[model samples]
Target: MNLFAALPEKERLIAERFDSLIQDIKPLNSKQLAFLPRDIQRLSALLTAERSSLKAGYMNNAVMLSAYTRYFMRWNLFRLTSLFAGMDTTAFDFLKDGDYCLDIGSGPLTVPIALYLARPELRGKKLNWYCMDTSQNALALGENFFLSCAARLQTEEGEPAWRIVRVKGEMGTRIKNKVSFVSCANMFNELYWDTHNPLEKEAKKYAALLLSYTVPQKAVFVVEPGIPRAARFVSLLRSALIRSGMSILAPCPHEGACPMEGKKGGKWCHFILDTESAPKNLQALSEKAGLPKDRAALSFVFASSSPAHQSSSKPAGGKTAGKSAQGASRQHIRICSDPIVLPHGKTGRYACAHWGLTLVTGHRIKDTLSGDLLYADLSAQDIQALPVDRKSGAKIVNV
Candidate 1:
């Protein structure tokens, strides 16, 4: 079953809303869109150029707006839908209490709409949503899309679905007050590669900015493309935030240093979710643009000011976690990376456990995938050794 199958009705509603949004755009037909063949070529070129410009921290908003309205808007809606659909909402259930959400670089209000649909309890709440963007056109388009969506739906309680406060500016020192949750998706990676600044300097700058913006016990979530560089940037940001007294909520299971950082060949952390269930209009756009729309691959970090939410206390299947070969309870090891196949048909994995970065190897571990809350029956010495076997002993417990 697809991830959203559990919430079939909501999934259908979200797809319908997305389809309505796309249909309203009235994409040109083949005869009328004879110019579209050229437009598509131009859009592809613009996207390529914009990517480089985006990395340099100099986005041409007018070009971006054109690209977005012409093609990427539907694509982004699909991306956001997949991301939000696959997410575990229990981690973000705290937002249902009328808390304020500040979405940095919230292009077209994707995060806000995704967040609302992901949490059923949040539907009728009177909440504050601040969308910070550098483009006035982007903000205007976002507000229009959201209002269009809200117009089609009715709340059972008859409350205004959401109140948006749009802020037009660069990310700076003007941290807003009472911002319960801060979301920055696909924004930090650009800032990380700002051509004028060194990467570490840029990462630290954004880290400090986020630290200053959010108060204690609140959460900040960042999402980026799943490529090695972007994923590594997310890891680096996670380390920076954790070192500054923040606790990681998902993706990482331990407070220890990221293993991928020191790996010489540039392996990084990222997750994948199927996006084949995207709205039909989005699928058509993807096909026309020659883009693979089947998968949503991205890296994200969920960090909170509260340390208690750092690690999972249990694993899948209700099994005892963190047991050692010596019969002692050690820290549970959660598999953080996809299993790496070794020469001897052995599978190796990098996991977050008590000893921080752990390398687990065994034939049985081949079945383990990322996001599995895992526990191994091995001593610290055993884990450090080569080719540890899960057949020797390991457990997967219910989280």
Candidate 2:
């Protein structure tokens, strides 16, 4: 179900609140927004620049906040909230009502706001939320935005939805609470660039830190931009967590080493959220920003200290079995990259199956999309020896 389906009335109310919030911010006007395109272009350059060359001074500050509030907020809030909405709530089924949550780099409390909107069950529940950030201004602003959202979403006489703690400091400074849920969204890339630390070192450090704050059956979620570099970094982070004994919870059907690692620039794994039918305010913002309102993309990893209490096996027909998890009728593979349409009339799709990276090709594979959990029959030949042809070892199945 869609996020707003739980409380239909709140959809309009939330959209109205977004309009009011933006209007209330005096400097965030059409003229300011018009100028934001330039800032957005500059910010994009800064983000994709070489790590050592970055001006750490301008990374996170009042200036950046102004740009975000005026221009980036519309896209970021829309994208992130859509991502949160599309998440599998089963990943959070283990969390209890009163469990604590810690959101690192909680800029404007994006993840928390999305969580509440996506899971209305969280409303009227006493969940403690701790927001950690290095910028006091960001924390203050986030607090205001979060409270406004909560006030609008909460009904009269209902239990307070959350008990929030705003902590201003570098994230991962210490493990304050045994958090039941932890989210780090679009924060690691900045950490990597600002600190000049290798992705592996940073991933290892944060993996340990996140684990320290998490109890069994709890989860840690990380999301980055959908770019190839960011996707690869997330893959590295996921591998580190897996080696550290954490279990894959969402997205992936197997915990094997990511199939995209050894390959050099073949395909990257990421998810897409269709945002064409978003709320009125969001659509208006997209139109104003000269950006497409149809799709939002991101790469994310969700891992838990305990294995998901569900069947790992793929279902009957399109099931593609993997070597990692046994006792399944069908094998499963995660499509890591977009399909390549060969000039010879067959489509080529790169996938991560139980046997490792497999080049899936066939006449029936034309409709296969990236990020799909595909199933096929590969028992006839070894996955490693399969030829890159339409008649490749496996035939596409129902999945």
Candidate 3:
């Protein structure tokens, strides 16, 4: 189910509140509006090609900060919404009354705002939110935006049930209280950005740091841009976390090693969502800024410190132990890529199963998409009959 697709009303409400809050922050005149696009382009370059040139505390600049809030931050919120919508609700089951959530590198409280808008069940919970960031300015603005949005929906005397505590610090900043949920978005890439450190080493270092913020059985959510490097970083982090006894909850159905990792010039782990669902105003602003997006691409990991959930356990591999009258075993497979057209008019899609990378092919393959969980039954004879993909080395299964 597309969770975000079911929340049109909430999406509209968030976009409205965001527009009202941004307007109050900086009411742009005609000339300022014209210059906004240019500012957005400059900021994009700094965050991308010219990122190394970007110094610390760059958000301190009013113009750059404004551009970020209008363009990057808005789009990030949408991306989070799309990501959360795709995930299973069980992933967020750890969050409950009186729970504590620590959001790291929370510039303008984008994660918190996105949570409030996307996950309505979490809104009424008496949760403590510790939003940490290096830029005091962004934190302050984020607080106002969060409160404003919450106030509109909240009716009680105190308004929002979640308490917002802003902490101005960088990554690894300590929190005095124990947290049940830790969320970090668009922040990990900045750390060691210029370094040539091995990806595995970096993943291990950051995984330990992020896990330290949450207690056992709690969860940590990480989001990064869907670029190759970031996606590969997420894959490495998934492995490191699994080795540390953490169980991944979303985007992966099995706990086995990632097959997409270490494959040169091949597909990476990422998902894409169409941008047409975003607010019309935000979309228009993106076009004006010359950065219109047809799709929002992101790579994320949702993991728990506890053991793996039974539903996400490894699939039976060509075993007849659980076979039915059809002489095939049924197991859950996670679709990892869009449908691929093969010779002989066969449709194939990459998936993750207990046996490792698999090519699930059939006429019905086109009906499924990346990030989908499919249950298929295959016999041992069927599995032994096909050749592996030469480029990706995935096992082929025709259903």
Top candidate when judged by lDDT against the true structure: 3
What is candidate 1's lDDT per residue for 154-272, written digit by digit as tens? 55434456888888776772645667788887777555553676555666768888766665658888888777778777877887888788887776656677755523364567665
lDDT of 2 at 4: 14
Ranking by lDDT: 3, 2, 1
Two-way lDDT contest, 1 vs 2, winner: 2
Worst 10 residues of 2 by lDDT: 310-319
- Give the worst 10-residue stretch by lDDT in candidate 3: 314-323
Most accurate candidate by TM-score: 3
The RMSD of every model to the true structure, in order and in angstroms, is 4.9, 4.7, 3.6
Kindly list the per-residue Cα lDDT of model 2 for residues 70-92, writing each as its tens digit: 44555566666655554554546
Model 2 segments more than 4 A misplaced = 1-17, 25-34, 49-63, 194-198, 278-294, 309-328, 361-368, 377-399
Residue pair clashes in candidate 2: 319-330, 319-331, 320-330, 320-331, 320-332, 321-330, 321-331
Off by over 4 Å in 3: 1-8, 155-157, 308-327, 344-346, 379-387
Model 3 Cα shift for residue 99 (angstroms): 1.8
Tell me the TM-score of each prediction against the true structure. 0.79, 0.80, 0.90
Q: What is candidate 2's CA lDDT for residue 62? A: 57
Model 1 misplaced stretches (Cα beyond 4 Å):
1-7, 25-66, 69-89, 96-98, 148-157, 173-176, 262-264, 311-326, 334-340, 344-368, 379-399
